[model samples]
Target: MKKTTILDLVSRKLAPFMLLFGLYLLSYGHMSPGGGFQGGVVIASGVILLFVAQGVGTTASLFPFRTLSLVEAAAFLLLLAAGLAGLAAGAGFLGNPMAGVDVRAVPRVSMILVYNVLIGLKVGAGISFVCMYLFREGR
Candidate 1:
């Protein structure tokens, strides 16, 4: 009946640190080795830990399937929109379109960071949802 065991306690304590690390990876992906997909999986693993430690029902309550879907959709749209922005700027897709412009806000570094964050959030939610559903189906 009790889900709050020592393992759960440890997971709870450790999850935040894992999440922070994942965010760090996403933010610093361009500068470092890791990137969006990697950080996303890390974050998803943290969520999966919570799901296992707290049980599917509890995890679902905190991060519902519908919410995950929304996050994924939003992230995807934003990522696409980002590419579309480059196209609109007449630099094709993902190319430096704003080079002739101010080059302050739409710089390459900032775009990469934004892309990484979006991709990280999207993949994290997608993988976590997959894990939860699989566990629910007894697979």
Candidate 2:
């Protein structure tokens, strides 16, 4: 596939904004409609755009398969650990650990925020890894 200078330049300029939007959605998901899954998809879309515009090799160098795999796995494990922590704390599975604490002491949505961040990371890494693998196979 031949790369065009225009495509490369546009993608380079636009991808950062897409990633920033994704982060915004992830961080404010508890208060808004968008959440981890939406944010992750947005992030993956940005990577995919770069992959198509710059070619898979260049994108892969920036986001290596090994690192993506590790991130996905680590995020998954952490999410599970969070759930287990809730269970061990007698809140049941996926329950909030701060349930008994005073509302004034901590934010009620703190756990949701953690979950959103982890899920966003997991979904973004998993999707990007899959897309990269497919692009590699197509080569």
Candidate 3:
């Protein structure tokens, strides 16, 4: 059983581009529309494109289950640690501690950007890993 077609090729070719778009959305999230969660799903869809174009095996090779799991876990822990840092700084849990920081130097927006990137990577890797794992099970 396989999925080999012009459409699959097109998807395979477009998957990286889709991933770039998703990253763009995540990077610009603080300034414009879309954010970590949305971008993360988009990135996961890009990974899905590989599965649909090739197969579970090929996709898994590109993104090993163990590596993906590690990345996902690291991203989650980083996000949690960032929030905890904010709380420890006396800004309350998940609060925007950057607000009180030296805006003229660091700028509060940087915190949001970092958070967005962390969340995006966490969610993207987690979702993609889950999908890949399930698809592998199916095979």
lDDT of each: 0.86, 0.91, 0.87
Clashing pairs in 1: none
Please list the residue runs of candidate 2 whose C-alpha ends up more than 4 Å from where it truly belongs after superposition: 103-105, 137-139
Best by lDDT: 2
Of 1 and 3, the candidate ranking higher by lDDT:
3
TM-score of candidate 1 relative to the true fold = 0.88
Query: On residues 55-137, what C-alpha lDDT tens digit does candidate 2 reach at each position?
Result: 78888889988999999999999999999989987899999987866778679789999999999999999999898888774
Q: For model 2, name the residue pairs that clash.
A: none
Which pairs clash (backbone N, Cα, C closer than 3 Å) in model 3?
none
- The RMSD (Cα, Å) of candidate 1 is 2.3
Lowest lDDT sum, 10 consecutive residues, model 3, at 130-139
- Lowest summed lDDT over 10 consecutive residues: which window, candidate 2? 130-139
Alpha-carbon deviation at 106 in model 1, angstroms: 6.0
TM-score result, candidate 2? 0.93
Candidate 1, residues 81-108, lDDT tens digits: the string is 9888889998889766566578654665
Q: Tens-digit lDDT track for model 3 on 1-139?
A: 5565886779878999989988998999999998999999999999988876677787888888899899999998999999998898789888777777666878788889889999999989999988887777454
TM-score for each candidate, following the candidate numbering:
0.88, 0.93, 0.90
